[model samples]
Target: MSSGQGGGQSGGQAGGQGGPGWQADGRRGAQYPGARRRPRYRALSPLREHLREAFWFAPLLTCVGAVLLAGLTDLLDREIFAEASAAQTADTLLSFSSAAKSVVSTVSSAMLTFIGVVFSISLVSLQMAASQFSPRVLRLYVRSRLIKATFATCLATFVYTLLVQLGYDDTSDPARAVSVPIVSTIVALAMVMLSLALFVLYVQATMRLLRVPHVIDRVTRESLQVLQDYRWLAPELGPTPGAVPEGPTLLHEGRGGVLRDVNIRWLIRVARRHDAVLYQVPRIGDFIAPGTPTVVVVGGSAPRPRRITTALNVGVDRTMHQDLSFGFRQLVDIAIRALSPAINDPTTAVQAVDRIHQLLAVLAPVHLGELRHRDKDGAVRLVQPVPGWEATVDLAFTEVRICGAGQPQVTRRLAAALDDLLRITPERRRAPLLLQRALLERAVAESVRDEDNRAFALTPDRQGIG
Candidate 1:
C-alpha cells in the first residue's frame, strides 16, 4: 500500500442572513451606505522605479571609477614633473608604490567625500520617488536630485583631474599638463550629469506639461467616497440550500479530452453545487428564463459521505477582508494627499495624484457578495449576486509595450507626477477635507470628459470647454 493518504472535503450548506445584497439608494444600510463603490484602475507606473535604480547606480560607479582613474594619473604626473622640472610640487607628488596604488588612493579619498553626498541624495530621491504622487514630495525629490547631480559632477571632474595629473610630468608643457586632467574629468562628469539631468528634466517638465494628476485625483476621490459609503450598510444575504442532500449520480465522466472539451468539468461542478444532473451547455453567460431547464438535480440517490467535515467558520471572512483592503487603500490615498502641497502645476502634481488614484481604483471589484430573498409564502429565491465586480486588468509597466526609440506615456506621466508630488507641502493636511475636495475634482473631470466627448462628437472644431 502507498503511504500517501487520500481525503475529500464535503460541500456544506452554510446559511447567510437573507435579503437583497445592495439596496437601490446605494447604501447597504445606515452603516455602509456607499461602501460598494470601487475606483477604475488605469495602469502601473515604472518611471519612478527606473529613476531610483539609476540614481543609486550612477553615483556608486562614478565614485569608484573617478578615484581609480585619479590615482593612476597622479603617479604618471609625478614622474613627469620630477623629470621635467628637476623638482616636484607638493600637489603633483605621488607617494604610492605604483600607478595602480596611487589610483586606488585618489579614488578612495575622493569617493569618501562624493559617496557621502551622493548616497544621501539618492536616499532622499528614493523616498520622494516612492511617494512621488504627492506634489510636495515630488518637488523635494527633484530639488535634491538636481543639487546632488550638479555637485557630484563638479566633484567627480575635480577629483578625476587631480588623479589624471598623477600620470603625467609636471614640467611637460604647463598648458598641456593642465589640459589632460581638465578635459578628462570634465568630459566624464559632464556625461554622467547630462544623462541624469535629462531624466530629471523629463520628470519635472512632463509633470507640469501633462495635467493628468488633476483628472486622476477627481476619479480617486469619487471612488473612495463611494466605497467608504458602502461600509456603512447591512451585511449581505447568501443563497439558501435545498431542504436535503439529493445526489451522488455521475453526470459525466471523462479521462481525457481536447482543450475545448474542458467545459464538461465546469458543467459537472455547477451540477454538483445544485445536487443536480447536468449536460454540457455550448454557450456561457446566457440567460435562463422562467421554466427553462438550467440543470437537473438528481433526487433519486443519497450523496456519498465525504471524509472531511462539512462545516464553515463563516463570520465576516472574505467580505471583511475585501472591505479592509478598500479601506486601507483609501487611507493610503488620504495619507498621500495629506502629504501633497496645495500649489503645484496640474501637469505634474495633479497627474501624480491621479496616478495613485487609478491604482487604488483597480482594487475595487464590481460587487462583493450576493443576497437571497424569501417571499411571504416561504418560497426562496436568489435576489441578485453583487453586480459590477469587474477587475481592472493591466500589465505591469515593463510588461506593457515599450520601444527605446520613443517616449512612453506611462513613464512620461510618472516623471511629471513625481516632480509635483515631491514638492514640500505648504499647508497642514486635513484628511476629510481633502476627501471633499477630491470629490469636487472628480465631479469636474467627469463633467468635462462627458461634455467634451459629446461636443467633439457634435462638432469638428471645438468651440469651448467640452
Candidate 2:
C-alpha cells in the first residue's frame, strides 16, 4: 500500500520500500496517520530496470537492425545506379521519391491506427495482469506494465515505418532500374511480422513470470485456513504454535484508572461475531485461564466432541484447562445446537463448520493482554501480551481478575442467544429421521391392531377380551 511504484521497474525487491519502519500498535500515529514506513534498499536505475522488465530488448534490437539494414540497402542501390547512367538515374530517383511520398503519408496514417490497437491491447494486458496478481500488488504492476508497453509500442512503430520507407526509397533507375524483387519484398514483410510476434510473446512471458509470487502467497493463505479447520488435532491452539498455560496467568496490569475490570459485554459481542460462545469461570477472575468450550459454537449432534478445529486453527487450547467455574455449560450446549444442523449435511457442512470455527478462533483465545479487568481496590487495569503464542483464553486470563457476581447473568444471556440461534438451524436432517421413526411406529401399531383383530375373529373369547 505504498505510493511508490515497484517490481522490476525499480530493480528493488518486488514490494520492498527503500527504509526502516515501526510496527503497528493497531492504531495509526497522529502525524503519520495511517502511514506505514517502507523497507530499506537500493534499486536499479530506471533504464536498466526497463530493460530487465520488458524482456523484449532482444526482439526490439532485431527490429532496429532490420531498419538499419534497409537503409544500407538503399544506399547500395543508389551507388550501383549512379555509375551507369547519371542523368537517367537522377530522373528515376526523383520519380521514386514522388511516388514514395504519398505511400509514406498513408503508412503513417496506418501506423496511427496501429498505435490505437496497441494501446487497447496493452490496457487489456495490464488489467488481466492486475487481476491475476494479488489485490495488494495489482496497481503497482499495472503502472509498470503501462509504462513499458507505451515505450515499446512507440519504438516498434518508428522502426517499422522507417524500414518500409527505406525499402521504397532504395529502388531507382529508368534504363537499368534497381527495383525490389517480389520475393525480397515478401521476405522483408515476413521478417517484420516475426519480430512483432516475438515482441508480443516476450511481454506475455514477462507477465506470467511476475505471477509466481502471487500464486505462492495465495497458497500460503489457503494453507493457513486448512490449518485452522483441523486445529482440533494440533498440539497448539491459535495461529501461533504454543500451548495455553495452566493456572493463574497475568492478563495485564492496573487495579484502577482508564483500564479496570475486563469489559465482559464488549468481549461477548466480539465472541458472537466470530460465532463463538463465551463462558467465564466463576471466582477465578479474568486472571486465570478457564474451562473447556471456553469459546463454543453449535455443531453437529455428535455424542462426543469430535476432533474438530478451524481453518485458522486458532482458539482455546483443548489440552489446557481454564477453570471456568461459571455454569457456562448451557452456552456450550447452545453453540453445539446452532452448529449441529449445518454440519449434518455434507455439502454446506464444512464451510459452516469452518465459519463457526473461525468465530471461535477469533474470540476464545483472547488473552488477558487483550482485556481490561479490575482489582479488589476497584482499580482498573489493562493486560499486555506475553512472549510467544498462547491460547486466547490463557492470554485473556493471564493478568486479569473478575469483579462482582452479576457477571454470570450476562454470560447466561449470551448462552441464551446462542441457543436461540441453534434452534433456528433446526435439525432438518433430524426431521427426516423423525418422520421415518413415526412411519415405523404407525406400521407397528397397524400390525398389532390387525393381529388382535385376526385373533379375535379366530377366537370369540379372545375377541371379547380384546
Candidate 3:
C-alpha cells in the first residue's frame, strides 16, 4: 500500500472518500439529480445497531407513543366533550357507558390474544426457517420492518384501548353521558382495525420463510445491493483489498469479537491527525480476540490502541454491512444444509446455488482487491484488507460443491454458474472460477457411483437439470 501515490485515484469516483463529513461531488453544495448517492451501508453505531436488532425496540417505542396518545384523548374527553351544552349535541353524546366499556374491554383483550398468536406463529416460523434453511435467516425476521410494525401496532392498540377504557364512567347514565369517551373510543377502534390489517400482512410475510426460493431471492438481492454499494465506495477508498498492515501494530484490548466493519471517518481522521497511514489487520468477517493486532501505522506514530479499536467494530456475528462474504456464507450454508442426509432436498440446494451464481456474476466485474483509503489531498491514509477474489469465490462454492457433488441438479447448476461467471469476468479474475471448475469435476468423478451419472453431473445446466 503506497501512502504517497495520488495519481490514478484522483478521477472518476462517485464523490466522497468514504469518510464522515466528506463531500462526494468535490464540493458539498445543493443537491442535484446526479449528486452522489450515499452508499447502501456505512459503519452503524455499535449500540444503535444492536438496539435495532432487538425484538422489543419497535414495540416499546410504539407503546410509549400509545401512552402519549392516550393522554391527548383524556384532554379531549374533558375539554371538548364536557364543554358541550345539552342542546349543542345531546343526541350525539348518547352512547351507553356500558357499551363504551365493552367495546374497549373486548378490543384490548382481543389485541392481547392476537399478539400471543402472532408471537407463537413467529416462533414456529423461526424454528422452521432454522431447520429448513439456515439459522442466520432469523436475523431476517428481526430486521424486518414489517414484523416490527405489526408487533408495534398490536401492542399500541392494546395499550391505547386499555387506557381509553379506564376513562369511561361505570356509574354515568346510559342516555345522559355527555362526557362519553367517544373520541378516544374511535381512535382505539382505528388502531384495532390497523392492527388487524398488519396481522394479515404479518402472516403473509412470515409465511415467506416457508418458501425456500423466496428466501434465496431475498438473500441474493441483499448481497447484490451490498456489492453495488461496496464497489461504489471502494474505488474512492482504496485501490485494492489486498493491502497488508506494514507499520507498528495496534492491538485490541479485553475481549474481541468478529470484525463487523470499521468506522472509516474516524479511522481517516485518526490517521490524518497522526500524519500516518493505517492498515487494518483483519478482513471484515474475521474474528479478533484480546491482544489481536487490529491496525498498524505506517508513517507517523501509531495512535493509542483505544483510538484504533474505537474505529473497529467487533461484534458477536458477521453482518452484511460491509462483509459481502457473509452473504455468500449464508447461501452456502443453506445449500449445504439442503444436501444433508437428513434433509436430502436437492431442489433447495439448487435454488441456493442459483442465488450464489447471481451474486458471483455481479461480483465478477467489480474490483474488490483494492483496500486503500485516501484523504482530500489523495494521499493514502488507510489500507484495509478484504476477501480476495479467490477467497470470495471459495466462500461461495467450496462447501456447496463438496456437499452436493453426488446430486446431479446441484453439480450441474454449479458448473453452469461457474462457467457463466468465467465468461463475463475479465481474464485477470478468471483463475478462481477455472480452478473451482476443475475441483468440481474432480468432486463429481469421486462422488458419483456410476460413469453415466458422473458425466451427467459434470454437464452444465442453468436450470439445474435441463
Candidate 4:
C-alpha cells in the first residue's frame, strides 16, 4: 500500500493532479516534516453506522411496535365487551371458563422454546460460514434482513400472546367471566402460524448464505450500488492540475485500524472552510498502523486536529462504503483459501473468479483516481486518493495468480478473465490487462509441461473447458 502525502501550490492547481503523483512504482517517496499541533476536535460516533448495519435494530423496533399493538387490542377488547348486548356477548365469548388464558400461555411458552431453537440453528450456520469461508462474512449473516425479520416475528408473537393472556378473565361470577379477550386470542393464533412460516423462510435464507454464488452476488450488488451512487466525476468537470510541493503538515494522530470509511462530504466542507487541500493517504480498505499519517493537509491556516480526525471513521474491519477494493478482497480471500493445500478446491476458486470478473467489468469503464471535491464556484476543496485502474486490476488478480500457480484450471480461468477484460476495457486500461496476461503466461510456461502450456496458451477458456 502507498503512504505519504502531497499538496498543490494553488487551489485550482490541486484539481489538475488526476492521480497520486507523489508515489512512484507503487512506493511512497521520502517523508515530509511532522504536522503541527492544533486544538482537539470531537470524533464522530460510529454508533449510527453500527445501528444501520446492525441486525438487532429492526427486531428491537418491531418488538416495541408489537407491544403498542397489544395495548390497543386490550383497549378494544374492554370497550367491545362492555358495550355488547347479551346475544353478542354470548356469540363472541369462549365457552371455557379460563381455557383461553391456558391456551395463550401454552402458545407463548412454545414460541419461547422455538426462539431458542432458531437462535441455535443460526449460530451453527454462522460457525460454518466462519470456518469454511472468511470470518469477514459473519457480518453478512448477522446483518441479514431476513434473519432479523424472522427473529422479530418470533419475538412479536411471544409478546402479543403474553400480553393478550393478561386480559383473560377467570372470575368466579359468570358475568365477570365474559370479559375475556377472545378476539385478541384469535390474532395471537394467526401470529403463531405466521411465525411458523417465517421459520421456514429463515432456514432457506440461511442456507443460501452458505452457498458461494449467493455470497458473491450480494457483495457484488452492494459494490456496484456504491459505484453508481457516487457520481464520481461530473461530465463538465475539467482536467486536474499537477500537485504542488508539500507545505502544510501531515496529520497521522497515531491512530490505526482498518479504514472503514471517510465522510467525503464532511471532508469537502472542512476543506472549503479552511481553504485547504486534503489528500487521504490510504484508500478505504487499507490498514493503517499507529503513528502512520493518514491525511496530508495543504494551504490555508492549519485546521483543528479534531476536524481532520472527525471526518475519518476508522474501525477494526473494512465496510462497503467507498471501499470497492474490500469487496474484491473478500472474494479473493475465498479464492486463495480454496487454492490452499489443505482445501485443494479449484472449483471453488473458479467460482470466485467468475464473480471477480463481474466486478471488474462494472469498474472497467468508470473513472477512478484521486477524487476531487469542489465548492459551488468549482474551486477544489478536498482531494483524496483512490485506487487507479491498474491498482484495482492488480488487486483483483495478483494474489489469485500467485496462489493458483501450477493449477491449470485456476490459471486458465484467470487468463480467460484477463482476455475478456482486455477486449472490453478502454485503451488506457489495457496496459494492466496486458501485464496480467504476460504474468499468467509466464506462470503457465513454468508450471505446466510444454505440451500442456500450448493448450493453456490458446485464447483464454473462460470456463476452463479443456
User: Which lDDT value does model 2 have at 369?
Assistant: 22
Instruction: Give TM per candidate.
Output: 0.27, 0.27, 0.89, 0.82
lDDT of 2 by residue, 341-392 (tens): 3322221212222233233333233211211122212222112122222232
Pairwise TM-score winner, candidates 1 and 4: 4
Enumerate residue pairs that collide in model 4.
8-244, 15-240, 15-241, 16-240, 16-241, 17-241, 41-306
Off by over 4 Å in 1: 1-61, 72-154, 165-169, 172-361, 366-466
User: Once model 3 is optimally superposed onto the true structure by TM-score, how far is the C-alpha of residue 345 displaced, in angstroms?
Assistant: 0.8
What are the runs in model 4 whose C-alpha is more than 4 Å off?
1-45, 85-99, 230-245, 250-255, 453-459
RMSD of each: 21.3, 23.4, 4.6, 8.8
Count of backbone clashes for each model?
A: 64, 60, 11, 7
Candidate 4 per-residue lDDT over residues 1-466, each given as its tens digit: 1112221112222222223231112123221122112111122358976875676787788789879988887777666666653555543454542566777899999999998888898899999888777887788987777787888899988888887776667564546554657667777888889899999999999889989788878877877666543322321223433353376655556377877777656776777788887767777777776566666777886676667777778788887766667788888888888898988888888888998998888777665545665554446666666666787889889999988877878887898898888888889669889999888877777777677565664446777556
Query: Residues 168-277, candidate 1, lDDT per residue (tens digit)?
Result: 44443443442223233334455445645654654464344233343245435544554543322222423322232233322222211111111222333333444434
Ten-residue segment with the worst summed lDDT in candidate 1? 1-10
lDDT of each: 0.33, 0.33, 0.77, 0.70
Off by over 4 Å in 3: 1-36, 86-95, 173-178, 234-245
Q: Output the lDDT of residue 101, model 3.
A: 72
lDDT score, candidate 3:
0.77
